[model samples]
Every structure is written in C-alpha cells, then in structure tokens.
Target: MNKTILLTGVVFGLLAVVFGAFGAHGLEKMVEPEAISTFEIGVRYQMYHALFLLFIGLWTGLKANKKRIVYTLIVLGIALFSFSIYGLALNSIIKFDFRSIAFLTPIGGVFLIFGWFFTGYFILTQKRIN
Candidate 1:
C-alpha cells in the first residue's frame, strides 16, 4: 500500500506539472480568463495534495502499517477534488455540462481533512523519543 501510494503520488505530482504547463501555454488562448483561473485553482489544489501524498509516503516508510489507509484516503481526496475542478473548468471552457459532480468536491475536502487529522492523531499517540 505504501508503494502504491508513493507511486501514485509521484504520478500525480508529475501530471499536475504537465497540466499546469498545459494551462499556461496550451490553454492561455483557448480558454476564457475565468476558465483559466478555474483551471489554475485545480492545478494549485492538485499540487498541494500531491505534495501531501508524498509526505504521507515518507511517513509510511517510517511508521506502522496502520498509516497506509490514511495515506490512501489523502490520495483519493486529492484525486476527487482536483479532477472535479479540472473537469468543471474544461466543461465551462467547452460549454459542456457537469453540475452534478460539483457537490462531490466538498466531500473530497472532508476526506482530505480527516486524513490529516488521522495523521496528527497518529503522531501524537506515538511514543515520544525523549
């Protein structure tokens, strides 16, 4: 699970960079200003959580097996939040429809919040090095 999370984190991080570049260069002229802003928001969140996943991966390497599920939730939350924004931005850009999924983004945010909460709980519960 750790390896899977780490590998997925790496992939997501790389893809976020690609999408950011695509937004900057490929989408600059093709998308409206508002859509571009929306896409940038997606990219920002994606990059943030991708780094979170990377940190989870590092923690997994040093922690107990119980931590893997929390990391996976973090990754899943990132995917849901980032992809929904990307899809919505694209839909707006192309004049397609996808309002139904917008509500899911908050749910993803909830997952992300809980993932971090669990991480903090684990850290606090661990035996102190002192």
Candidate 2:
C-alpha cells in the first residue's frame, strides 16, 4: 500500500508541476483569470490528496487493521475527488461543458470528509504499542 501510494504520489506530483507550469505560462493566454483559478483549484486538490494518500500508506505500515480502513477510504476518496477535478479542468480547457461535472465535485468532497473522519476515528480508537 505504501509503495502504491508513493508511486501515485510521484505521478501526481509530476503532473502538478507540469500543469502548474502550463497554467502559469500557456494557459494565461488561452484562458481568463477565473479559468486559471479553477484549473489551479483542481491542481491544488490533486496535489494535496496525492500527499495525503502517501501519508495514509505510511500510517498503514505502523498501524493495525482498523487503521488500514482509513487508508482505503483516503485512496478511494482521492480517486473520486481528485479525478473528478482533473476531468472538470480538462473539460474546461477543451470547451466542453464543465457545469455538468460541477455536481460531481461535492460528491468527491464527501469522500474526503469521510476519509478524514475515518482517520480521526481510527487514531482515537487505536491502542498504543508497548
């Protein structure tokens, strides 16, 4: 799980850098400032969840079965949440309808919320190792 998360993190990190650079340079001419902000919003969520997934993987190794659920939730959350944002941003760039995808963003947000609560619950409920 840790290695899986790490690999995905590397992928996301690379994409973020590329996309961020594109936004900073090329996108400026093609898109309005608000569109750029929206694109950056997607990139920001992707980067954050990518790191969070890595942390969950690391935590899985140090923790118990109960905590593994937390990792699962986070991974799933990132899949749903980050991927939606990426799709939305890409669609925007292509002149596709982004409004339709707006509904999905909140669903993704719910997953992240669940992931966070699951982690917190697992932490509070965990027994310390001697």
Going through the candidates in the order shown, the clash numbers are 0, 0
lDDT of 2 by residue, 38-118 (tens): 778877877787777667666643455654565566656666666666567566467667667677777777877887887
lDDT of residue 39 for candidate 2: 79
Best by TM-score: 1
Q: What TM-score, to 2 decimals, does candidate 2 have?
A: 0.78
Q: How far is candidate 1 from the true structure (C-alpha RMSD, Å)?
A: 2.2
Which whole-number lDDT from 0 to 100 does residue 56 have in model 1?
Answer: 75
Each candidate: what lDDT?
0.78, 0.69
lDDT of 1: 0.78
- Please give each candidate's TM-score: 0.86, 0.78
Q: What is the lDDT, from 0 to 100, of the residue 26 in candidate 1?
A: 88
